[model samples]
Target: MAAPVYQAPPMPTDAEIARDVRREKRGRIGGRGALYLAATAFALFAALPFAWMLLTVFKQNSDLYDPNLNPFLYNDPPTLQNIGYLFAQTEYATFIRNTLLVAVLVVVITLLAAVPAAYSLTRLAGRWGESLGIAIFLVYLVPPTLLFIPLSRVVADLGLRNSVWSLVVVYPSFTIPFCTWLLMGFFKSIPWDIEEQAMIDGYSRIGAIWRTVLPISIPGLLTVVVFSFALTMHEFVYALAFVTSSAQKTVSIGVTTELIRGDVYFWQSLMAAAALVAIPIALLYNAFLDRFIAGFTMGAVKG
Candidate 1:
């Protein structure tokens, strides 16, 4: 063994090390570039429909109806005729107003009912909380199509038939249950120690909730608001069943009914109406995207 001693291999040179480092950096840059390219592709794909709608809203009917022309490009000068027709010839403004009113009222009502229900189920309801929470969530799964007939009678009895107020009344029945379940997940993710610490500082249970729990649950609340508002705007079954007057109609019903006659369709004006309503909601979703994702992901994992 003593006679078998040998010299060790030499260390790499400065040039070799520098070359390897550059190679690694290049690999990382290539990976990041690929990821960026993929992300950009996905963004464009998602935006394609919106871009098409925007273009169609301004396109002339002749260009739109032409079979030989490129649908994606303008074959003629853009005009505001479709937009003007939407505003002037339809009850689109009324639809928007009614939709907004219902959305706002539904959001408010859902928050009021859901927040406390979620907190109670999460904290106060000893061992039956999960069972009760699931039962409430099951109510949301019942289709509007099945319930609309009975709901219509209730609406008529309340004299809210053919009124926008009927939507305000009916929308919350679904919104509250789902929102309560959603908020429960948020509340569960919050530590009990935070509320207890607030209580130790002389705050009552209600005060602790108001100061500590609710503030921490802002993301959940925002999720509720967005869900309620979107549902109210898009709901057609109940809206159609209970409300028939053009003055009481929402965007979902108004656009289809007003713009589509028995055989004729106002394609450009319909697209214009859709673009107006959809663009703002899309912007809103983008604005609160982080919070919305946090709300859903946290709720899903925690629940």
Candidate 2:
């Protein structure tokens, strides 16, 4: 007549539970390992062309045309003669000056114009402002071929055709819309409380924007600057379209047209020249890349 002895089911031991957790963790780590491997493969794919360019620049003329030369390794005696000849033979310096001037001017003008326009739209624009902004940037999304011809006539009317100032006028068509749209997003991300507090403290709307917002949006500004600079520097279609004079030509046009004579493509010298042209751009992007990504990503998300 004794009551049945009650017994509890045995719990899983610490080691057994730990083994299950470890198994899950290992699975996660293995997935991450595969992800890293995939990323590395993509990176290598992207970088191979650049590596070839670097190798080609240093390769001798004899080695350059040879499909037999080891691509990943240096041909027995690597030389700087190609790079040396590019500088010595071509009007490389003048081309560089023209490119720099156009790029800087575009960057300055874009920031000056776009920042104010964005601020106005965000602050003072009524209900239609958002629609207007989206619509305006869409105009920029239009292909260059459609607009460049009409733009040419306009440039001639302004007497900017065949002038370096032509790029100054032309680049903003693209830069301003994107920059304005980008700044709108960055401005939205900013807390309006600080701006309102500043206005309450006797700051004008413009003053509050300049002091409270701009200082925080340096990254966004640099993104616009980088875009403007790159567009002015690399856009051959407009450059070739606008400039015909040898003395007036920008580097992009000059390098592609003026560097080679006949079918005798100066492969080594051409690549060396291109690499030189590409270096500053590479530097600019790499230096400000973080800001550029943040600005563009924020813009795309909000927009």
User: TM per model?
Assistant: 0.89, 0.90
Q: Ten residues in a row with the worst lDDT in model 1?
A: 1-10
Error of 1 at 217 (Å): 0.8
lDDT of candidate 2 vs native?
Answer: 0.84
Which residue pairs does candidate 1 place in steric collision? none
Q: Look at candidate 2 and tell me the lDDT of residue 265.
A: 82
Best by TM-score: 2
Residue 84, candidate 2: C-alpha displacement in angstroms = 2.3
lDDT of model 1, residue 140: 98
Off by over 4 Å in 2: 1-18
Residue-by-residue lDDT tens digits, candidate 2, 1-303: 999999998998999899999999999999999999999999999988877788888887677667887766776689999878867887777778888898888899999998988877876797777887888788789887778899999899999888878877898899889889888888777888989999999999889988899998888888888888888788888888888776677888877777778877887777887889788789979998888898789888975
Tens-digit lDDT track for model 1 on 168-241?
99999999999999999999988999999999999999999999999999999999999898888899999989
Model 1 segments more than 4 A misplaced: 1-34
Best by lDDT: 1
